[model samples]
Target: MKILVLAIDRDDDFGVKAGVKGPVIGRDSCLDAAVKLSLADPEDSDANTLFAAIKLYDELKKKGEFDEVEVALITGHPNVGVESDLRLSKQLDEVLKKFPADGVIPVTDGAEDEQIFPIITSKVPIISTRRVVVKQSPGIETTWYIIVRYLKEMMSDPEVSKVVLGIPGLIVLLYGIAKIISIKYPPSAQIVSSTVTGVVMLIVGGYFFSKGFRLKPITSLVRIVSRGLITFIGVVTGFIVMLGGAINVYLTLESIAENMIGGIPTSELIAFLIYLNAFNKYFILGLGIMISGKIIQEYLRRDPHIWYYIASFLMLPAFWKVIDLMTIYSNPLIKKSPETLIAGVLLVLIDLTLSIIISIKLREEVKKWSSASS
Candidate 1:
């Protein structure tokens, strides 16, 4: 097996500190980088990660477990969040073009770099993952070093700073709102709770909006928006319908509970509410449709694995409704019906048949395509 030992530096911290940027290929290059990086910034975690990958490569070569073994290091932009991940993907693409490997073993020092697991696995199969850490002397001094390092990162990194600042900002805003409300009239619990909820929603909306703006992939919003329209529309439409249905259901239930609506049997009214609640099934249906659209999009891009995934996921709504209906009909505690039970069994058979067919077809397609590609 020809294997690659992959080291992730998602934010280029190691390269920036050690003055070694881009993909550092092979055992010698990576080992040299680890030494230089460790010397340049002895405290950098990426230095430790690099050393681990080099060590792993040496061990595998010495043990003669693999016919060929290589090592690589890839980094990304500092400030871009998902953009940095995309850049990392591009770098991996370049590495694959030059030096293809059967599988990769990703090595990371901490959570920050390890967060990009999907990016690495998407490009090549991962045999295993390794996380390296430099053992620290156990003392108050080590504790202080960890604290200062974390605080400095949180303060400097926008990703961490936003959450840290948002919490206190929310508290201050809610307190001010409560103080004003109290001056006019002593606020009730409802008022305080509503105020806090509204503030939280506002903050969450702002954060997502800012995050969306930061996704600078392709550097063109038009293309991204155009491609994402189906999902965007589906989600927005589903949310609108769900919101209206929830409000309508709540009022209807409240009226029934208070006996405000007359001339309707309570049992029938409750059953009717159950049927109305099922209207939210369209919300799930819309999501399934959006996912199907996404699968088609991926298919157009010629990703083989997505075909198998889509074949399974396309059954989402059917699987949901069939299982729900079957459970309702088969429960002996709730008046049993032979007719509904038989219907449920037939539906289950149909679902199983379709699933089996799709699975077989997917298996064939994957085998054929894998042979052609290889």
Candidate 2:
């Protein structure tokens, strides 16, 4: 087993709380430093300083040299008693004796990096870096991952996780409601609903972009590019399918006129319904995959497995809707249903199934790459 130690100065507390506990540097001193930091211009002292500590830990973990590593943060004022070096050395010494691992590493991001160097020598390796991913395992319990652990335990609440999920759910609900209302309302209502849905999708895209950019575990440029390209292809293909559906509808209408059929033929309507169903199926599958791709980008940067699991979970619901839509003509599952809706559902299902297969394969490839590299 490998041991990872985090030595944090008590005075560096910029209002963020950490998991590990240690000595106090006096509340007054902490307050004074925070006030100064707040007044400082052009620099974000809090996040940057915390980021330094996280960077060091992440780099070491990525090296994959250890069977297992536990991280801890030590807080206390080094200037309170003896020399700062001696003080940290003694604190670490006590910790090492208890753990007794093959190797001991101390990670710090304090103003006294140089001060603590002399104290930690060949026996303990001290490192500093700026690339860090702060997250808590969503527990190994059930299917519902309800909690999030952030860096330094600053945002460790389960409610935070719930809120994040809630936001997306709210967006989907509002869009659904707007769409339903538009059917009963005027042209203006339909336009407003469409605009609202587009805006929500954009916001969702932006959220994924930030996650992809900041997460560090996935550091592969090729994988990143592949994910983006796949989403783009999905979007383009979906558009083409929808266009084809429109053309099919026009051709069916013309055929009816040329044949001089007194009324709409059952076969023509069936064909139209099948094509329409196919169009909607592809459209929804593309949208879901595109959104999931954005999320996966973030996971690639940070923890790829998390979003992989999430996307897998969402795949089923989208697929179910498509199947239900397209089977309307052939199945009597939903009684008194117009064949159009059934056709749409069936068409969507086929596309969703294909996307699901592709997603699973891609996830396996990513897993292999991650394990080999980290």
> Candidate 1 on 1-374: residue-level lDDT in tens?
88988998887876678888768787788888889888988877788788888889889899998888888999887864787788788888888877898899999876667668888788789999987766773233335546877999989998788788756677778878877776777647568768777887787776677678875444445675687665455455656766776666555664533442243424754545443434446455555656665666666656667656566664664676574564444332345567866776677677767877887788788779878977
Which residue window of length 10 is worst by lDDT in model 2?
A: 137-146
Tell me, by TM-score, which candidate is best.
1
Superposed on all Cα atoms, the candidates' RMSDs to the truth, in angstroms, are: 19.9, 21.8
Model 2, 86-127: lDDT tens digits are 555665566556555455454433333434555555456544
Q: For each candidate, how many residue pairs have backbone atoms clashing (under 3 Å)? A: 0, 16
Error of 2 at 174 (Å): 80
Instruction: State, as a TM-score between 0 and 1, how close model 2 is to the true structure.
Output: 0.24
Clashing residue pairs for model 1: none
